[model samples]
Target: MGIEFTALHWIYVVFIVLIIGFMVKRRDTTLICIVGIFMLAIGATGDFTSSISGVFNSFIYAITELLSTILIISIIVAMSRVMMTSGINEVMVAPFTKIIKTPALAYWTIGLLMMLISWFFWPSPAVALLGAVLLPVAIRAGLPALGVAMAMNLFGHGIALSSDFVIQGAPKLTADAAGIPVGDVVSASIPLVITMGVVTTIVAYIFLRRDMKRGTFLLNTVSEENEDSTQAMEENLLSIGQKRFFAVLIPIAFILDVMAMAVFKLQGGDATALIGGTSVFILLLLSIVAHKSEGLEKTTSYLIQGFQFGFKVFGPVIPIAAFFYLGDVGFIQIIGDHLPATSHGIVNDLGVGLAAVVPLTKEIAVVTLTVVGAITGLDGSGFSGISLAGSVGSLFGNAIGGGTATLTALGQITAIWIGGGTLIPWALIPAAAICNVSPFELARRNLIPVVIGLVVTTIVAMFLI
Candidate 1:
């Protein structure tokens, strides 16, 4: 039977076209998402009352599915903030500073720290903390602000966030769409994630070295006056004893958490729970250490600040994710009431329809999926587009033969690595803002290396998966 386009499907297509137009014009994604949702609701119900209700229901559903992960991320961010405000962030990176006296070492050190911290606390909080403390040191050690930003983007957002071994956000979405265990996605992603990280980091290092040789490297450092200002900021944020305690306690706690997670078979939600529970414990500890008598009030204050930071990091991406979520049959059925009960894979159906009209080979399919991933990543949130990729992956993979999950994972990685901010100007804003570099410049510097790494990773996945 020929696939017929319903009003709801047409509305989705139009919404996608508008969103793409908005992205090309460098307009706001959040605004586009809201408009897209409105269009989808109206198209599906064809009645104002039901359309309005559908919009509200979709919004609520989106938030409900995401709330647990968001809350966990927020709490971890709060812990990082407490660590930073308590001066633990400085102490955490101090050891690396001594070892990373050169630009090369500084780049790797910063990347490693970002990966480690992101694995535990997630990239959002990790970037904030790393930028606040480690960026200065790396820059002073002769690493360019652009280079530091690139490393953080690749390692934290691209690698750690993609694997999501600790929090499992990315894996959860992919697994749900594929009807596989989250643990399967997590396990399957690790080798791919590691390959991408190593290739990307090495390529980035080579580019940085080439730039250094050409004397195009920019030194990052504060003036003596600015150093004094920074010190003052530190003093106001942390007392001597509080600084000392956290300086000792926070790292030890994180190391223990890692060991425990590894020692135990904690996976999926359990892994995130472990990290969140630890973050709360650490938050309480820092509060007690920092505020003493007013610890309760102070801890609550820090948590509020952390939530604000988390929302700032994640809030803008949620609506975009909601729109993408509709692309999944599971979610499409919820949103598109008239969809057939037998229509198990809506994304596959759409891809198949397109495939029939447009000539597509295996290589073309792979490239198309990669490009789609990169496009989805334009909103600068990596996990947001994963469900779409997973859905598309299954469709194309089955058509091509076997290895649907593998291709889906590859597509997911590419989308996240590129649009997740490693090589896109607008997407890199958060990391650029934290590193005090021009986001455009960082994106430009990152493009070649990241692309090379992505190519290598895709090829590797084709064989491995």
Candidate 2:
């Protein structure tokens, strides 16, 4: 007989519901979810192992699976820190100040720039560079700070990072889970990303334009304005030569990095590595330029500061990601051996069961899978939910006579775009925090345009795939 819905399945159901409830409550659900998963794993394994050992084992397994991706993220983030300390980040964005003359232009400029930089360096570092440099200009251009934050959140983290066209981290994970080539995933994602980008950007522009017309689009808070003015006064007292040299050199280096990446056809992650490594080198060069003989000591201080900033920006995301790693078979195989055999891979098993029941057309199955991906994304970290989506896509693809790769890609696109930051405040916090806006309010504002764009993107994916 086929497997029944045992105690393990019920436990999984409870945990899933709890997770959903916690997300809605906007509480710190990481520990709760982890505990739930732990209990479920124990029940599945039918082991009376110590809770401590189980937790440690599960954590170790999850961390091992995620170590590479996490380390890569950290390295890039660390490199970004080096750039900030050297003032290269500020120098890189200074030129945009001259071109962004109005709120509408500022929005697009910031959005496009964030997307471009994020494509190379990932969104975490891109936020720092944009927030520190372009934000003041954007604010001065009368773009509402909230709007600027939203733009960065949507374009940088959501669209660019989600697509991960350059680095391929996101695509690699999705493809692995779906059991397809990274190249295929990348190829499939391009049209979907473009469609989503255009639709979302247009919708965002409408909202921003309406606000601009109403004269409510200025995002510069009083405190930040005072801080900028104070810094300006301080800067005016210093000699301009140092600033001028840095201003020119930083941009040149970054431009060269970009050129090299494009000309060499470096993969996304490799391109990010190149950018990050160059940024570090530039940071070192600038520290000497800024501090003269004291450059060595100052550089160390700067590096420390940069790491602190990166960690502050990315730390919370780590644990959240750790919990979600449980859903992946790559990690599950290692940690879930202790789980009752019946409870093993509850997520994938659930997907298989669901696929068995649903007599879906290709179009219907694609839409349903995409919707499920989007729903799973409500947890706010796009990568966390993708494994389940990919697994379900594969199962349903087989059941409904569709391509697993296509369905997985569709699900991946939906999840990343929705939960990656485009529609959720918590997921967009890094961008929002750097832009100095409230994450909740940013999410509220993003609801309409992002949702509309998602709907359009989903329709397009269904027809295309």
Best-matching candidate per TM-score = 1
- Mark the regions of model 2 whose C-alpha exceeds 4 Å error after superposition: 1-18, 24-27, 36-45, 50-54, 139-146, 172-184, 214-351, 369-388, 401-422, 425-441
TM-score, every prediction: 0.86, 0.76
Winning model by lDDT: 1
lDDT of 1 by residue, 1-465 (tens): 356656656666677667656654546667766777777666666677776666667667667766767778889877777676666777667777788788888888888889988887788778877776666777778887777888888888778877777777777776665556777666666777888889888988887888888988667433354344335334555666667667777778767777887889777777777778878998998777666788899899888987886677657656766666676643554456556554544555665566676665667666767776777676566666665667667667655655666767776788778767687777788788876778888888778877887788777776654
Question: What root-mean-square deviation over C-alphas does model 1 reach?
Answer: 3.3
95-196: candidate 2 lDDT, tens digit per residue: 788999998889899999899878766787788767767777777888877888888988987789778876666776666555456677777777878887
TM-score of 2: 0.76
Q: Residue 190 in candidate 2 has what lDDT?
A: 78
